[model samples]
Target: MSALAEKADSPLKKKPPSWSDIWLKNTKPLKHVVFTMPLQSLSPKDPKSQTLIPTFANIDRTLLLSDELLLQILPKLPHLQRNPNSLVCKRWLNLQGRLIRSLKILDWDFLESGRLFTRFPNLTHVDLLNGCLLSPRDSGILLTHRLVSMQMGSGFCSNRKFLEEDLLPVEVVDKGLQALANGCPNLRRLVVINASELGLLTVAEECLTLQELELHKCNDNVLRGIAACENLQIVKLVANVDGLYSSSVTDIGLTILAQGCKRLVRLELSGCEGSFDGIKAIGQCCLMLEELTICDHKMDDGWLAGLSYCENLKTLKLLSCKRIDRSPGRDEYLGFCPALERLHLQKCQLRSKKSVRALFRVCEAVREIVIQDCWGLDNDMFRFASVCRRVKLLSLEGCSLLTTEGLEAVILSWQDLENLIVVSCKNINESGISPALATLFSILKELRWRPDVKSLLASSLVGTGMGKKGGRFFKRT
Candidate 1:
């Protein structure tokens, strides 16, 4: 029991029992536990806490979602599912209606019954062409004072008889228009067939935001109603399509339209007959007019001269026209459109050399010229386009009579030309290309030369290694 004996005994003494060992010795033994009652109940309730639990069948996830979250999700669904989604609930129906911006109404009652507004309050575009028809699905004869006497004995269908009673009363049509105008104050575009002036006047007065309007079977008087559309920029007036209907728009209607819609930017006249006076009014008054499309027109002999008055006109399209002008008058008197940039002619009959030359003279300042499917456009007729010295883009298609030499002569004169597209021209072939024309093609910024199917197939097979000789079927020439 000396000091050395005490030190040795201290080293032998064990350290205090560790905490983990002490806890394991003091903890209770583990036992398996099982739930006695069912995890779910049909009539689950906590009476003591005064709370009611919901069942899976009674719970609705969509109802729990906020309107803001639903709005974000509903639009991502495909359009085909919209109709079914709308039928899910009243809230969904209202939300789906808010997304519709355009409607083509075939039923007049849908617009007149004040339902369209309640259902879709944000509509911006509407088309009422079919609604106004007497028998939309059937062909009905128009009842008027002048009637064509058909031979009953001839080869006419006996069952196909159209009577005047099939047409709707004028008053009934006006009521629908009034309802539409009152309900859709934000309408921006409208299309109607055989609409009266009174009906259109109501629409123009209410829908001041209207920017585009199309009127089929339009007459001189209908334009009077259209004049009220102050914001109107684009208009397509179809007087007649074929011999089926006899409606006319003359100088008087043109003058009214021009004076009222001074902000007009684009105008299309289909089967309309006008003189110099009408064209002059439009060119002078509609200072903002940029595009003009004339289709199957019946203008006077010297109506071409009036285009010069359109100082801001940029694009001119001639479609399915029988002639440019019977007589465009002297070249000195026919001034050019100062700001004209593009001239497009499609499916036109340019048979007369005199009229074609006059048209080329007027559009001499054009930068782009596109001629497609034009008949009687030979080398002599195509030469007239050489006057467009500033042309930068030229697209010629379906010009059967235009030979490679004719195109070369015209394009060589265009020193500023950068883009050229020639397709479906039978007379233009790779064999006709000269050294000078080949050099021009090389210097061009972009060139698409597929005058026939053989060239197009060869070009497509060029890089794919589909053809012989290293897939270089189309030579440089």
Candidate 2:
């Protein structure tokens, strides 16, 4: 053996550390720099010209990414976590506050103060749907300046607004309206549940751009307030109340609305005790009115006579109503209005055959007929469709009195009939499901029970004041 081989084989020989061992020890920077070779390759030669390595901060981060990038990200995070992210740094907090434009707090109880307005100064929309029934002190805290669309829902007791005020020491008053007027001048759309007439009137004065409004349990004074909104194109008045007799919006209120709201194109009255005179006045006064929906409202044919004068009228929807037109002589004047296009009857009762015939005769020009949950209508009433040949769509739901045989005979004859929807019609299912009816339903398009699809779609569009034409109606799933 050579002298070099004898030295390698010696037990006392000092061995050099492996590359992995030296690299793993972070503290041994000098050894790593010398051994890894690559670490020192890019090391600055001039100590004076050297720069520190990049980091989350201290580097030219503003050059690499702008504040605008951060502003876009912070607000997009979930609301619960947004606060945590903002707490990370002052820059993050500033971006979060500046970037938020709209806020929708489902719980009103959690909405503590005007701090929300300060936090998001540029907010255009605010929806406080729940917790409208807050105490007087808490209710007073709801003040916004920049809201364009607002929907505040609350519940109240008492049939009359005045009674409600008397029962509850605190009510939506001029004070609240003053806040909205002072802050939300750009307000265009509002849906407030259980607000007083005076408060609504105050809104009309402040929100000149107001185009659409929905008020639950409105009264004559409320209608007067609505009249003040000269730009109003759509209005829905709901008179139903929880544990209350009814809202005090009768023919008197309707008359007020008809006289003042000339720009109205669509109007809906629910649970209103309005008669023919009030509705007739609407047709006579509101020249721009197009669509009308009356739900659970008191009426007879007097309104039908008046509807003949609505030159631009297109659609009429009767829901959960009874005796839509009983004044036989006057409604005869409503025959064959070419512009009237669609008729929808839902959960209604046509007490007399004469009344049924009268209603259908006026809608002879209607292209679509939607019938649902209507009683006192028999196979004989289905024959009305024969005369109304223009009806391309016939939708029937829960019409227990209507038989399939009677419907098949009338609908099949109409060449323009494009669609027929039959759902939960008890009498129709008694006999074997007619092959002809089955084939008709199978071939026809768009058939189903639409519970709230129309309203939901409309809310997403009209409630937000986002679309001009608003939502198209669809069957509910």
Candidate 3:
């Protein structure tokens, strides 16, 4: 053997250090070494400058090889262009489709041509707001069953042909709506405003899976077609008819709808001239009704009293429905619905405080009460809040008669008030709200008021207005 080979094979006189001893000696420099290599490699490499290639070239290859890691890092990269991450690679283009579930086609020309749905096959929900759904030249695009919910404007399926003078041709409206209804088989919810007679008929016959339907400015034909939906749970109708014309909806249309929909839970009728007989029909027929909103010109105390028989009603909203001046008989009849939880009466001239008190006494489970623009609600009605302790939210906006004393009395009675809004109330000053604030300070989550610093000091009793230097208000930051 040569001299170098003999020296390498010879055993050491002193004991050599183990792996742990070597690791302990190199630990401090390892962080600096590991960090500097990446920094040096990240600098721009120039082949003409004779810069040597990194020994860790394989490490860079290993880090960039993972598709999952690339996907996770692409979103974090800063760019000056529009969605540069989307333009990164084909993998990102595939991910964009999975992120979108609902698509609303607003462009009239694009929707009328039916090219949008063809591109996005995964779309299950579609909204055609102020746009027409055009008929397909080929049957393949119309027969793709994907859409489940749709909302459109009125005249969506009318058959009238367009003339040269018309901007929006009649052919577009007829073909678009017909194609949409016939295409989307799984559709369950349909909302249409200003619907034509033919459009109403088409939706009722074609949309078998529809559960909720809303009709605005509709005629008797629409109401009759809505009655045909067996699975309908909610139906809202806003009638727009001339004063000279009227429909059978006051009695016959309502009767047919109530009998047809056994599962009906919510029904809203606004701007309709329905009589007391119509109200009576609803109470008797809609046994499963949970919510009812009625707004009309002639709704009086007698019409409201007729709703007492509706035992399952939990929510009722009556707008501009006044009580008759001499309808003393209907006062006692108001205390019928015991299961009601929410009641909203706006612009209603409630006759007396006794009538308001009678309502609370009957609906003992009421949690929310809103009375806006109401005349004749005196101090006596404010006292009723004390008796009904279950109220969680209360709003009295534009009730000009509600004084500070009246507000204090109501607040003193409430033990579990969470939200209280008193707007446009001129009489409810800081002094009137101080006591209620003290009682509800800990429990109250939201309180809205517009008061000056002097009023705040007066209400807080920090500046001798109420003869106290400091109180709970000082500690409530």
lDDT of 1 by residue, 48-103 (tens): 54334545556677999988788889989998998899998899999888878899
Give the per-residue Cα lDDT of candidate 3 at 54. Answer: 52
Highest-TM-score candidate: 1
lDDT of 3 by residue, 388-416 (tens): 67888788887776687777777767777
lDDT of 2 by residue, 166-278 (tens): 22222533444455555667766666555666777787887788887876656787677788888899888877643432567878888888888889999988777766588
Which regions of candidate 2 are displaced past 4 Å? 1-51, 54-113, 119-130, 134-171, 429-477
Instruction: For model 3, name the residue pairs that clash.
Output: 133-176, 154-194
Tell me which of candidates 1 and 3 scores higher on TM-score: 1
Please identify model 1 stretches exceeding 4 Å from their true place. 1-57, 64-69, 136-170, 453-477
Candidate 3 stretches greater than 4 Å from native: 1-129, 132-175, 196-198, 241-249, 283-288, 295-301, 319-329, 345-364, 372-389, 411-419, 433-477
* lDDT over C-alpha atoms for residue 50 of model 3: 36
As a whole number from 0 to 100, the lDDT of residue 367 in candidate 3 is 80
Candidate 2, position 428, lDDT: 56
Candidate 3 overall lDDT versus native: 0.59
